[model samples]
Target chain A: MNKMAGSSMGEDTIGAIQEGIRNSAARMLESGEIDVFIGYEDGTLPLRTTPVFITCPEDAERLVWSPICENSLTCYLPKFQGTVGVVVKGCDVRTLVNLILENQVSRDKVKIVGVPCKGIIDRDRVGKALGTDRIIRSAKATRRSLMLEGDGFEVEMEIQDVLAPSCEVCRYPVPVLFDVLVGNESMARDGKDPEAGYLEVAQFAELEPDARFSFFAQEIERCIQCYACRQACPLCYCPECFVDRQSPKWISRWRGLSDKILFHLGRVLHVAGRCVDCGACRRACPVGIDLRLLTKNMEKAAKDLFDYESGLDIGGVPLLATYRREDPDDFIL
Target chain B: MLKMAKTDLDAFVDALVKASYVVLGPIQEGEATKFGVVGGEEIKIPRLTTRPLKELFFPQDESLLSFDRSGTPDASVDTSGVLASDGISPRVALGVRPCDARALVLLDNVFASDDYRDPYYTLRREKTVIITFACPLPGVACFCESTGGGPYDETGSDILFVEVAGSYLVKAVSEKGKGLLQEVFPPCILHEADDEDIQAAAEARARGELPANAGVPIEAAAAILGHVDAFGDSAWEEVYKKCLGCAVCTYLCPTCHCFDIGDEVTGASGERIRNWDSCMFPLFTLHASGHNPRPSRKERFRQRVMHKFNYFVENNDCMACVGCGRCVENCPVNLDIRQVLTTFARRELA
Candidate 1:
């Protein structure tokens, strides 16, 4: 019943999942462990998804879940008070964990109904991969299989063939912590696939010294400082950001590579160790900057140096909070 | 001690396969010296990183999983099964300035919470070591003392290196720093600091002040917080008028750590993710039902001040700030955070 690679389940499966969510929410609402049930509902745009919070049992009927539910809806947790029930896929649960960590929400304040994640496809990528204007009508995935149907091409692409950048290196095929779990658990990566996007990091390292600077320059040069990536991130929980200072302009308003690189560098630093590898920044970018590269570098650094990852555990302290006398400082004068 | 009389910083870097640590300091990428891991061997010191060093742990964009859209989900594919030994490794931050070191302490309150800890940051914290450089002179954006910090405070460093004439006077503040430097440098004698050295550092700070910022009025952030309700006007609107609903400020802040979660899957297997988020965005305070309590710039603007000055101080006993001035220096539209904070102190609160 899981949506895995190459499985040809249709929109019918999507409907069933939505109905199951709605029915469960309505029952939870009646029981009153939650005052509001936050989940995803279908959008007017084909395959687009929007956040929905159902208060009344009647409103719960509007709840719908689909493949297009791209946003990690934990955006509302801090602003949301009182007891709330949230429908969380494995990735979204990290938002729940983050809120708990920040003390923004009480562990008892929200009830999380967890869903296992197989892997999600990038709608834009699907359109690009198909090399057509036709939108992907629907998608079905199961273990080792993925079936996608677009405007005219009825090709069943391997899920690995078109996996999103963030998914290629996903280490947590499961939630580190959760209140509830849905369906069966995913089997461990049956011995990693070489196509799992490792080449991107290698590609970054493979470039000559000067070429890498150009590569970063190209990415930073495109940033408009819109901060859509920051806003979309679940880790950037600061009530105030630092770029708006006037006494000293840290980054220039002028759209130059220097300012853009400063902006990205500043951004990545604020989140270097905490980045969870969510593709929201890439998806939220209207300019199509591969911010993923910056975070990926940080991710590699975090793993190689600190041996840590975001959202994998519930009780771990952040990397910089505790210092080890013997922690590496080989470059210091 | 391993002497480096001729082998200065440049030669020291040349000794490594590729300086084992990611040397992040001020780089003139564009118009700013934003902090980034050195690509090869580059000497970027004293220059501000356009942003603060806060992002070293907090991050603006991050992923909890790789939404594979391809795997089969069984009970084992859930997030609860994730182990802590999977990712992240130890690293040494190369050019951390003193103010940046203090900023890390400001962030530690939330990061090291006993109720719930941020595992992502904790990993970095335990493994990464900081070697703080002394500020030769205060920048136009600096106001460290006003925020109960200084340009030379060792509140968050493993080692501190003061640039004294021809040599760097290094001191170890924490045990980690001391142990690491045992073999790197001669034992630094702890003594009553000379008044001449202190005076010289102060003189450098005075000389670097800009005319417009020659004498910025200053007061305790707590006294400023007391007037949160007093700054209750359109000053927020006028100041934030140019804001593009972007999260630039929060992304660069040394202490801001708000975030949101996401979930993705393919077949049955999926992973949850948490990425950085901010209150500047309308969606930050938006309820799932479509109602946003912080509906406008005024409320949002005021909220930022209250949290940094009042709420943080009241709760954590420290103004969740370190006066590194990254926010004041990085705004695209030139919306300065310090000016706003000071203005709120002068006009609104006064």
Candidate 2:
């Protein structure tokens, strides 16, 4: 979405969406409509983006809007006492809409300042992009190209080449619901283009049943019992968890094969109809594991049987909890 | 005096709708009564609903915010939301069981806290007035009077309607009830309830489906919950061995309000999402640093009881549990909650 203005339609502020963000943050705070503004600030890594809670409009000057940012800060919205302002993209707007649908927070209480992102710098992909020698010092992108300035080196790469794998299948690249939108650019990558999941699902059948079981067994054996998957998910909220169910011990957090399978399997079930296919669990893993395959299998099963997809619509009921009288009786017999 | 016959349920519904209010009544959906958006004659009315009306105000699942791919969140306005933000529209909830009506009042100790104000709940609550029906017959799981409820406990209702022979014996309790009675006064009959009838009604309550034998004193039950750690005295392993961690029991329970929020991003933008969660899940209490406080279903099961009985009463003077029995009836393994509580109370198992 870098294609900025050059003509009468393109004001100087339209060069990068960052300028507009600065203006909006200044106005929102000046108007007293919001107490704090959540925006993007620099991370410890020069090229990475971290979500920043900007209470001062001057701090808005320190904020930078770019593709390197990835956070769903809707969880923080409920904890705010007074008026709060937030930044959102397409997927983030879906979460906001869901919250609104549930009546957890009023739309009037907060200000939504939106930005359309082109692609974010994938840390894993970038490590492979420049090989092991290059240390990324700083990076910025125009509408078309991302320039990475590293230690004793400079490199230019196509935005698509550095985007995260999940972004490759991203459908909504523009803001779905926003109050004030920045960067009037949009892309409808609804996967009319070549998608990855169909190929993976097709290839899974080619593997024999024994091979599949062995493959899962081998992969699960390496599980270190870390719950990076749970932490990354926006939906795994409980005051306490069951992996540690002391009363009956449904699943243990130990590194045993049974424990690992139980942990992952039980987790997938809890998110059965509720999971929105965000790929956060797969991305958050310290170990590179294809955790998406299990979730995607559940997704395929839900679609094939119940004709359901999570987070597709704001008003649609969550599939797992709600039941129709006509629901299949597969488990009944 | 005009007598509104039982077959005139159409007129009964029409009469409520013409009263210029969004009419809500008991609806028999699946095995629950939480669904309360019926205003026409197609509505089903039973002697009592399995669940309470609290779900109407504090729904099972509601959204706090929506996030986009860009990591920005936009809060929802209304998709023709069931109720308006302001208190108007004159809502009348008909056929609410007295137990469910009292459950609404019980829920208030938590919702009406001085600290956090749930605006959505408060809005619907103020605009709506309850019209409860006396439980002509309780179900297999009811013990309302044993726990300070009766065949007709009345607190949150505006109008209390008793189903008699040909017409309804309507008792106006609140000013809103008085106003509603005036609106429907044209077809009303002034039949004063006598002492013998009230006494006969009280006696008839015993023969009804209510189990006064549920075996927990309402007053001391909350006190017994103070010893959350007292589970050490029982065999908890036998209690939860077959538990599959499916979380269906917690999801179906009327008062289980735990939820989780997440984000789904497509490129530069993504949406943060919130969905219902259960302590039955292994990751519900998992920490980012790889440590979990309650790392097994057994401990999670223990927490469920402590939170409902001990922690809830410790904080809000009332138990979070309404004894809806959804957990008991819907368990995949047929694990009854009566057995669980009985085991905790050290009662003789059948």
Candidate 3:
């Protein structure tokens, strides 16, 4: 398990990508092409990266590119007023596309510097692999393996074993749209079959209806109603969420099972067509809820029934907004 | 001081259970570990629970009172049941870390204050006994020492337990703890502690007391934040940029005690409830006329920092934060509070 892959993209590729990002960001800021550049910087802890906003050319040097850059920077688009330069992974570009299509952000105002993603690391997976009890003092990442060190212990594991679940089934390793692209796109993992993306959803669908209901019920019970999932989602930009509305309240603030279910299901429906499966909601959830189960099913239904995929065709009308004669009406009854 | 063998933990827990105490400890729950009622399973003390210890005293949501308006147009609400401070059973919270224990004391200033007392919180506080496990290993995110707390600090714990060799050197910090020790540790039950055991316990505590990270000048930060002009500091603009306006930091915070009370009605019957609230949320400061004083994430994030450092210190003579580091570990965007504190600590005041 400790053996590193010899053929994987090495540190040289990552360094080149980082350099390219810094050069692009500095040039853009210097030329007045963008007012601000959003990217990742080394976080305080190991295997983590914090979002950094660079408004000056000199500050652009702080930008780093690695598997640890897990946050989708597109979520900040709605909050900005001027032209914004954003570093995006493959999945983040999809979110950016949705934002543009929804008119939440103007396509002209964004300078998208897209990076071909190998895969982002899941901290929870790494924690579980190295025993959660062990405190990781430091970490060093190579091309294919990560070496974690703690007091009296050191462990090395291949990067593939700790990739986020969403990355494993990712069909878009290369950004679908970008104004400027960094790194050799060929170095990224090959795109998987579209059907492969729905494997987990298919397995979940096999469960009995009661089992599915109980699964969600059990998962939602752990939710503390912190709304981290909602806040992390780029699509959930409503001025007032339905749950928070005082007048004609949809879900009460009480921590009841039904109220919790209403909030989760309500969110799933709100982002049904627009969700790009960026894994932000899952990563943001503090309780480790399997939010993708419900979301992926919605994505699959949109694919099977409406033959529509979100954030792909920028000119196409949203799945829910545009109604066609061929659209499935069987659920209406 | 007393000592008990590590192998005798089950018997000790059994003894506590037999004594009519409801024991709660850290239990492994799927991928996450949280504080729950100790059943037959062994209690493995993790560095920290997924959720903080505040939930045991202040739940996420709880019913305050129930009312019925079906009988008359103008009905009198019965609030007597809400504040009834009787019949609360004794509870023992086991394996609490010093940071979390210190947080309870911070919360006590809010919930059990001189001006007003929340009976619901006071009753639980009065009935429960806290048993803290002196930390032997602090995590990467932990900076409890920087926030006026230490690995072996006994601020709110009734009893403090330190692991030494194959046994635990237990020290009673309160009268209730001493009484309980007398009841549980009969002459035949506990081992007589010696100098070697005490030395080992001290070494273990020293290991944990070693700073996990460089200490931030929290006192200096609090002083700077106390300045009225600090509210308009440009640092707030940069510090809050990456914040997603999520309540993960506040809700997971053991010291944050803000709550919202609302009435839920179904036709003629209704129930009043209190739920945890966060300054990170926009709705927390929304005015009736829709004129929010804290209109954006910037103001909200600033309020969170100021409240913990300046306002709380000014009012209660203590900082509200215990530096448990849950916010640092769980922030989706990696907005570290330590960095924010460090920024204010080194800021130049006008």
Candidate 4:
């Protein structure tokens, strides 16, 4: 039975998805279908969730499905041993797909439990609404509404206002591939020009060159150089990242504007064709710097120039690896 | 020693600015609060700063000394002339919390030991004055009580400020603090702090108690870590699984002081600089002979736990952590150190 009372969940169906995930995880574990199952569990803090590694069948009860499940669990795949089962949302599935393509993980050695995601809630927006008094005791979410209760106060907010920016404009809501689907498929996205895809990148490109440079410089200057963005990314699986290499030190630890710009731009270039735009890097960043713009532009370039969208098929060659006779080389001169 | 109206705080800071002290205060940068050069504006002290005041002293990157090895590998390296002078400058850091202050004292044991004292750290330590605000409301993640520090702990602070009745009861904690206070504010500017002020300060301190479930078991932590064989335990596997091996936790932690030194060379003119390092990174323990002692995340996480609880306690007679909770609050995957400690303690008891 669902424990949530007066939740006003209505036709949200997250409850059904939650139930489905727990059942599937338990059955799989008991049958020895997978060695470990990775999913999200309720966090101690309100409006937050933590990634949980389930090894035993009984521990599957701890698994949860909620709008607060923001992390892309696929990042854990490369490090996992033996046959593993993982939970993935629409965007997270892209990471799994890319991981398989990159030979980071074998397709047959893993099982994917894909979830039809509406969107994950942004904790910052919730904090902003609650303001300085973060004494939130409990919070419940429905498809369209979220209700938070605490000492002497309760706030009911439209879910749209609190949805993560990446989730809000998410084109993929249904997982592209899943061994077992947990929830009903989300409604198909409205028809749009697939070739002209990088809307955010196009908007960023519209800025004048100087304005663009200043924009990047101003944004990156706030970076404390923690490298959480790199650590959180699935594509950044290099044993020794360029920033960490001291011999030919590509970047310094200085907080200078040039160092900051180089780190962000350099990272985008390194993961040029492979980046899946899961927004994990931006979400993991404590300073909330918009690191998505540059990477999104790179993704756009890969798409427009090569007519490629990554992780669509595991057998397809990587964008940078393949060569075409008709490939545009106008800048070669 | 003195009672200052809350409104007069800004004026006091401005006076410090006029006195040629580079006054640093908690400044709001996006979602986080950082200690930055005061802009003659109101200081918005958040529940706690994301990065501790340790950065001001130990710094993420500092030039120890640069050498000129221009000609050949065997050429005489000139140590006399350094690229950046490690000069001491007087500065006042305001609005720091007690937990962060205590962590600095713990750091002093490492950087300013009797055997070898770091000049760069010592110079900054001598020149700067730290004024801390008694924490009124410690967050859920904070565990200062367990780490042998409290909300109003004055272990490392020069002055402690307690807000009472829209005014501050400022107590000079050390000789340096008292002298600075006297030089900045005349006798006429301050009134005697009475019984009410002390009572109010106690109440403020009480409000910052460590949340019950999240309390650090200092004795249990030390006991579990005390046994060398405990390093081979299986509990670390669970603790490290959720960790992304990110530097965020160590970088944000108040007590983690591991650093890596390297040279930035450009056509023979280069400076050797020290930058923050984290045990969570695999490369932190990598050897030149392509052999890493602690190659996996499990060993790395275990090293972090042992270093804070066991190693630091053995070396300095104090736990390295002051429980500022920046790590707990900022870990992307939400790997709480409190949980790890509680699990270890419970397992040891069992």
Candidate 5:
């Protein structure tokens, strides 16, 4: 078996946060404050981390914090009937907040342990950097760089060069909502400029309507209709998605371009204002479709049109669920 | 064994193309590597394609038949052109991994069974010649050795290509492969492999084999899972929690062959189609009477494991999984099947 090892820049800080999470989780589990603790554990492969659920106090020691801890544990929030103590990064906590706002998960039923995040390492970018065909045998990440090793090759890349696109423009490196905060909040990396987040969306919007349509058509054509994007998003918690409905079958099972487009467009509209730009959908896609082009556009529209952002306030109403007199009515005509 | 220089691979592909063979290999498709028609593009065989090779034979969605309401009902039904052999041509699938090649054999048990045969699958299987490339170094997620397969196991390959020093030692595993080799390389072009070449290939095979300790006790897990009481085991609750109910694992798995048949109707015409179905989907087991035996993700997840490890073994005398590690590597939640098997292996059967 190949030996796998990983180290991150600011190892000391990450270690402290992980330790803090373990201690708090153990304490909560033993005290019956929560039935399960959701966090991350070492994945089988390099440059990956899998969500881990700890039901026993002893298992809290398995909780880990790393740049690769990218999953939003809030996706599992609605499934738990009892109180859940879940570890959340900045982006993930927003998802938790969205779940609470939407009433999919009761705020009282979840104990959020928030860790200030730097950024997640994008595996796709790393793969591209080291030629897609090169099998990564082992990976080592330092504070600012990553060293990848294979059978006969080794490549080193700066940490900033391989961060998930969502992370690069993150506006919140520190969780806005948390019951227990791990590590000093002040130690978190400074958030990037808010407007800079939508630069890609703005550039995409500049394309002619035909060009945009064709681009999306080409992208959605590769979809195998796996619904990984919907399954990965915490906001997409409907009991039965429209695509899966039998009576009103919105989309057929055929691998046709129209049905594929309908599924993606429908999903984007469904999660229009609720998506937190967590990048889970893109990461979950096995085919690596650029799902953010549509999702991020909806996010930008939500912000620009309604001056609204999701997951910031638990008391806030969903964007589509409410209407105001001040809301733009020109589009209605 | 016949030796082919590393530099002559393109020419060999050209020879196959010249012989009217549609050559398919691992081609980079945007961000993912997939088995696609290789015209003149470089065929860089990754450890494994992001998508499985099964797609070439059994597509995700295929039309079974088409019918028109305007004509007489009996006469309107047409199945002649649906996946017909008129356009079907001889094809070569190159750079197939041993595990994926093994997966085809497992699929053959289902699609080309003694009791029933699927013409679509049988036709493709008969037309395509598979050339498997032996892995010299296994990836982190690979566990083919644990499931009665290995990096160099050439169970279903027509031809096996073992990378030796600066060249490939190609061995024909089937008569079709031998005939193809004779046509492509002939006697003058094909050089006999030397002892050094054979020794190097052996060493490479050994290097790629998974360490004995790395394997999960799959056989023991299979045995335990076969019992009826295993269905109600509490361990399933924990194992199924992390699954996001996504079809990534099943879609990418080479051995997963379950499919759903549906009819798409238009104003005056309709087409019957079959699509790949996943046990991970909530709708896969929904009965017409609104009764679903596997109602929740827990039961669905159990069915996936049970079908692959227990039921398949019972039916075919072999596990359905090929241990290609696609699920292990691509699962969003990192729900490792190896760990699931280990949990069952260590469980006390009820």
Candidate 6:
């Protein structure tokens, strides 16, 4: 099994890190360095995780770091007032950094405890790999394989086959910025080209315009106007989304082809340069729409034209917020 | 009751199609099972469809009426060709879960009420027939039994199918179902269900085919929830704390029938359309005067629960939620409604 496929780095490595997290959180809470410790706890559903808020030192044991901790806990920072200790993974760190840069969250109010992420396993992918709709009672992950126990029997499967598409291409395995680090820094995989992030977008760009539209339309058609994609994203903290506005209604929340198409385009455009490529929106989508295609195109455009990477530096001018004289405008009429 | 082999279902669907009945059933798309027009593909059996059958009756969006001004300076309003009315054809929704079928009945309380009758919903309800499959073992998140729904509960379905040892035992719950079955399946294909078949079906339900009981004090919770004063209770703060206010739960809910009507105008000639709306949205209760009652997520979330449990029961003498568990499965934060109900139940007891 490929080691980069979001499997547990080893029970020992994870156990030590979890212990470190609990101890650190408890100390912070006890010392009053932080009023609230935000972390993930085991979710009610199998292969899922839920964000937990710990205020008391004794509650720090509720915090756990694992491959299933999929939520970007930093999203909760803006909703809070006091100094909050947040457990963040690689993508969440970038999101937190971006949130700080955007002034959505105050850096002084947040104490970031970064967890070394191989990658977070996609729950849907695991279900697909298991090839069953039965509820998994429990799942145990080893270094190379994942054992899923359910109604009748347990099946051991290779982790690589079940890693999320985003995880397969993730560049940051270790958090670049952290107040406290948990676990040893993970090595980036050598077989995959981390720098070639826009390969999928480039490949899709090669398709004919009609084919591309059809590809996008078919995916958007499945959207049920849940808005979970927008709600789950750390960047989408707008008090009023355009779709929700009434005075100059941008788009209707309809399942019609036109409405679906317009909503997708409008959302992608809104988050063009601000999105951190966190994969939270795609993961949150219940119908499994390929949202990355749109977001990745925007990411590629930001990199190629503006020479910008979001959340890369502290307090830097955002791509869309500040205009550079060297900005590429060849496509402009 | 009549017995038919599972293999003969395709022929039943073909016969229904031949009779010009729009057959809507589970269509397997990638890893998800969604409800759509049957296309000779293998019908995904038992699994609760991602898209509820309610969409068949109350569509996501449809034009209500069109206005034309180009013909004459004064606009000529046309109400004759409302989009849904043009094709008010008979439909058979097969492979529906019992909870989903029950949800339609719950929705009827509002749409087909004596006080205000929705012609659009009424017409669809009259034209459609529901064929439900007895839900198999419930998943971890299911609590159908607590919400007046069960594996074999057949309150709203025209026909109910229970999986027996080797064949499906079908029971007609309504006159429409009886006529449809006789028309679709020949006597030679259907065997009179023996006592053994009925017994086995009972045994399946007795073995707890559905998930564990919810144990929520529905009666007490409903009573407490119905009070206007209970709206300010502190329980709402904890219950709605995790909610991201995305409307995923409400959109997927089979019984949620609230809609927003608007006009899609195009150069002075346009069509008035109705689209699904969720109470979870901040704008759902917003007024033109900039005043809002359920302004915050906490209030919005409480409104959802109260509407489902208290308001619906007060109006219709029945709970609105059918407990299909779609909300539980798809909630982005895993904010289980079952937990909320249980919490309220505990509060009521306290």
Best candidate (score: lDDT) = 5
The docking quality of candidate 3, as DockQ, is 0.58
**Residue A208 accuracy (lDDT) in model 3:** 100
Task: Give the per-residue lDDT of model 1 (tens digit) for B1-350.
Answer: 11122126554334321435444555554333455665456565743454567666755444444434344352444332332433254456657877778888878888877766777777777777787876665554567766766666678998776665544455677898776555343323233346665555456545433232323344543575666455566556555543435666676677877776755334655566555667776656777676778887667777777788878877888777777766654443334566667666566444
Better of 2 and 6 by DockQ: 6
Model 2 C-alpha lDDT per residue in residues A139-244, reported as the tens digit of each score: 6655556677754787888868877665665556566667788766553224312235445655785899999888778767655344656645555644456765
Model 2, range B25-86, lDDT digits (tens) per residue? 76644223444667665765665554446656765434433333343365333323324433
Cα lDDT tens digits, model 3, A1-333, are: 111121233557777778889999999999999999999888888888888999999988788887878898899998799999999888888888888888899999999998988888898999989986898887767657788888799999898999998898888889888999998798688888868999889998999999989888889988888899999998888889988786777787786899999999999998998887889999999889989888888988898888877887767677888988877889876
Misplaced by over 4 Å in model 3 are: A1-11, B72-87, B186-188
Tens digits of per-residue lDDT for model 5, B14-115: 888999999999887657778888968656778899999999889999888888887655538788778673228999999999999999999999999999
Off by over 4 Å in 1: A1-217, A220-225, A228-333, B1-7, B11-32, B65-87, B183-221, B231-238, B347-350
Which residue window of length 10 is worst by lDDT in model 3 chain B?
Answer: B78-87
Sliding window of 10 residues with minimal summed lDDT for model 6 chain B:
B208-217
* True-vs-predicted CA distance for residue A210, candidate 5, Å: 2.4
Model 4 segments beyond 4 Å from truth? Answer: A1-12, A132-138, A149-153, A187-197, A254-260, A331-333, B69-87, B186-189, B210-214
Instruction: At residue A227, give the lDDT of candidate 5.
Output: 93
Question: What's candidate 3's i-RMS value?
Answer: 3.5
For model 4, what is the error of residue B239's alpha carbon versus the real structure, in angstroms, after optimal superposition?
Answer: 1.2
* Per-model TM-score versus the true fold: 0.48, 0.46, 0.96, 0.92, 0.96, 0.94
Report how far off residue B37 is in candidate 1 (Å).
3.9
Which order, best to worst by lDDT? 5, 3, 4, 6, 1, 2
TM-score of 6: 0.94
Interface RMSD of 5: 1.4
- How well does candidate 1 reproduce the true complex, by DockQ? 0.05
